[model samples]
Target: MRPMRLLGLKTFRHGVHPPESKDETSGLPIRQFPFAPLLIVPLVQHMGAPSIPVVEEGQEVQRGQRIARPDGFMSVSMHAPASGLVRRVALAPSISGRMVPAVYLEPFPGSTQEIEDGTPCPLEATPEEIIAAIQDAGVVGLGGAAFPTHVKLKIPEGKFVDTLIINGVECEPFLTTDHRVMLEESRDIFTGIRYLLKVTGAENVIIAVEANKADAAEHLRETFPSDLNGSVEVLQVKYPQGAEKMLFSALLGREVPSRGLPLDIHALCCNVATTAQVGQLLPRGRGIQERVITVTGPAVKRKGNYRIPIGTPLRFLLEHVGVADDVNRVFLGGPMMGAAAPSLEISITKGTSGVTAFTDTAAERTHSPVYPCIRCGYCVDACPIFLDPALLGKLAATEQFSTMTDEHHLMDCFECGSCSFVCPSHIPLVQRFRAAKAAVRKSKAGAA
Candidate 1:
């Protein structure tokens, strides 16, 4: 046990400072969002193989009961979010605009919604057992990546992790779900940290937070347990600072090798919200059924943080939040990296952290004319990864997808949108890069 040290503000080179639009919901406490009559629980809410349905249509399930089982080690299980009868198990619209297999559940009106618990994993459980419990619990990176948490915790045969980093640096604007989770779920966070420490065998822990979340930092400092070798490090406010590579550079000054993982550098990073879920669920033998989300934007009349059930349809959520008549576009997650909803019928998944509704006026601001790149070097100056987006953009325009990856390191671009944000020419640099990368992947897969 050591005293939790509050480190001085630190940051990596080259990032943007988008307007911090978090004030609208940062102060709001998380409230339980009312369930929609029909919950569309997608089987592919996470990365990897979609969970296979274990309960069939017309079956009754209690809240927290396992509805789908993980297909394999790379996948995670799924649970019922409420006491309901399975209406159907068919293809449903997901946030990604894909029609994936899903369970359509209709909640019984006035039901107790009692949760069915499984075998709890105790603190003293072995690392092997803990990892199994986590996968069975269906925890994933709630910070938007939705990578299965159990898969991440399983260290490779030869690799060793000495440090565990809890990421609380929600640098994306208009998103305060992680901030609210930090303030309200401190106890669960610490408990999650313990589980992560055991799973990764990390002797030291660092909770990385941006200076913009001073209140969250202070709250965590006050509640930090005196038994763990961990500290809360406040970082300089910057866009994409929460990325795993950027966090490594800002805190440890270590650059993860290009295309390498955190474990390559003896470090493991987990989202604060994800960690809190691990702490909150494993001990209770519960699977993840819902998550905290920040629902806000200019077009929203009731902006706040909410504990929303998984599979809640976007249309229902927006209706509950009261959107403006002129609401023209709605996106899941933050503006910089979120995807626009192709249909409001798409259901929220584990990866969704924020819901932003923009009016026609707000959407029109981004419709500026696209001009040729002037080589003003603004994109290079703003790229956190130090790749030349201008060159990559040109290669993409010429359909030189292979050249873009081979010579310009186009694949290294995380599509943080900083290049597009700072580009004076208003070119869709990030969008172009995304398309180019997809082309490259398709080519490689076809050749294989």
Candidate 2:
């Protein structure tokens, strides 16, 4: 209707502002990180079913080869990151610490960048073909979640998606990969949107960028020539604003039901980097080989955005990037909501957007020794989900899984880390609640 009267800067009600370490490379252009001698690709990069292994250890595979096939509708295929021989198809350490199945490839020295089977397709492909092409490309959400884009675009039978909300809000501190991609690959981002709109039958396409990245917003607004058939809206800068529900709330002023997705609210949000890759893959018919990752933290020597390959070992990435020799912790994503790695020896996955090397000092403020809650209600004020994280934290502390979900609405929590970040008593609210949720889910599964 009435152009919605420029909401100015829209955002959710609550969130905490952690240090925005994005300055190191916020303005830097996207550059290809040099191919490591060995690439460690994972089998379950997407959210659902894991891919089925197609290549065996020591299998001589060429560049653009299919290393694994989609396990089901929920899964996407895995491809060779480079022209190289498969070194091993075994369990490898992931950034999360646990061993996950991986395809190790030692790149052929001076491997050709040329694809062996690049059948260029015209952009005028039908919706079904475009969806199939996306699946063939093995593209997943490059923004942290790693959800299969093909699946996301598949609007359920009678359901209609009214808007395609492309996420350009790199709200996570220390991650500027999306910002650089927006500035550098605006064309690719648009290309991906054209196909996404066609496939999803979405009449509206809105690119959502945060107000903090004003330079990136200005660059895209200037470059896109709004004369094109799309909408770009700059959102209010807020922590967790990049999250699906928060961004949807900021743009549309709607809240996705607890434990529900944006699709439930007639919306679809895709990361700018993922869409850019969709642009690259829809035509070339290739799989995800590598992606942009922001490497930063107090311990790092050269902190900036890096275009790292899938399955690149964290140890190698950190060492190459020049982190301080003695590091206390390494986080796989941003300081908030990211999983801390047990060690730096884990391999990067499709969801690995930033490898944050937090030294003793950098990791200090975000956490503090837990103390008895004074019923301060600070967490209540800080929670974007409106759930009582303080109560959830209490339940988790006492191993009360049922109470956390049934009474406290633990599932509603996105684990945005705001509760943990804002707690004066230094409570690890998010981590404990996550464990409680997992236990409840397991118990429910057993009951079923």
- Which candidate tops TM-score? 1
* CA error at residue 438 for candidate 1, angstroms: 0.7
TM-score of every candidate: 0.98, 0.95
lDDT per residue as tens, model 2, 266-371: 9999999999998877677777788898888889898888888887878788878898866778888988867889875678888988888878876677556678
Steric overlap count per candidate: 0, 1
* Candidate 2 whole-model C-alpha lDDT, 0 to 1: 0.81
Query: Model 2 clash pairs?
Result: 40-311
Model 2 segments beyond 4 Å from truth? Answer: 1-7, 225-227
lDDT of 1 by residue, 312-378 (tens): 9999999999999999999999999998999999998999999999999988848999999999999
RMSD to native, candidate 1: 2.7
For candidate 1, report its TM-score. 0.98
Q: Whose lDDT is greatest here?
A: 1
